[model samples]
Target: MTTTVAEELRRRELERYILEMEWEEQIRTRQAEKHFKLVEDVFRQHLGEAERMTIRQLITGAAANGRCEAMVYSFPARCCTDGGRAIEKNLPHWQKTLQGNAKELYHVFTETAKPQRYGLRAAVVDFAEGFPAEIGFFVTWEPLFFRSDESIY
Candidate 1:
């Protein structure tokens, strides 16, 4: 049996499409592996050890920008016990869902920053398929007016 020219072209096109799809899948697999490794590294360290530079940078930048809040840390939502749903929904128990370094950061914030009138906030910073993909911890403080109004001198 002899193949027509149009049939030959269609076969080549289909083969090219399949190869492209496979390449895309390979790329995605590599990216996922890298992301998982990064997440693991973050979870393995205490916040003070792994994140001091990040915190300093965030605070410095916020101050330079004249902002009262800065996102000091972020991690994949998959690290959370509830996949960041609690944080996304703003639940009071969201801190309970935090794992590893995030939990440590929260504890340190509550113990130290909170007493100093600096606030800490956790929220889902990214989403995928209507679910949280990443969570961020933001350090916050009231501006002068609100601070004075509350007599937080």
Candidate 2:
């Protein structure tokens, strides 16, 4: 089989696209791992040893009866996945839920990037109806660039 010049060029372009996608995925994976560690550290400070242990169990426990909802938000970038933008748009609903649910706590998993600059922030909350009865949970990640005056970080 003979390969034409056009076909060879097309093949190279496809290969390049695939490589770029893989690289991007790797970057996201590293970011997520960093975020997880940050979350653990922040939670350790806020909760007692026993409480932290319990929370850990709940977070990692597969037996817990609940649904996990995850969201990722990115801003200051013209291009983002639909999933990322959807999470950003739903902030109001999540905020309202957080306000109403007395038992719920938004544990910030991680915040990355420069202060007053482009960055990523993430949080998770487990909603439990009663003892060990976690009904559902929500996780959110937002990547954004902030103005100097903004203080949400």
Residue 23's lDDT in candidate 1: 55
TM-score of each: 0.61, 0.39
Residues 1-153, candidate 1: write the lDDT tens digits.
999999999999999999866655554444334333433443335555445555655665564444667787899999899999889889999988889878877886776567667788988899999989989988776533323234221
Task: Name the TM-score of candidate 1.
Answer: 0.61
How far residue 98's Cα lies from its native spot in candidate 2, in Å, is: 6.9
- Tens digits of per-residue lDDT for model 2 on 1-153? 999999999999999999866655554544444444543665565557775555444433311222122332212211222322323444534333332222233323323222312222333222234222212233433432336475432
Query: TM-score: which candidate is best?
Result: 1
Per-residue error at 2 for model 1, in Å? 99
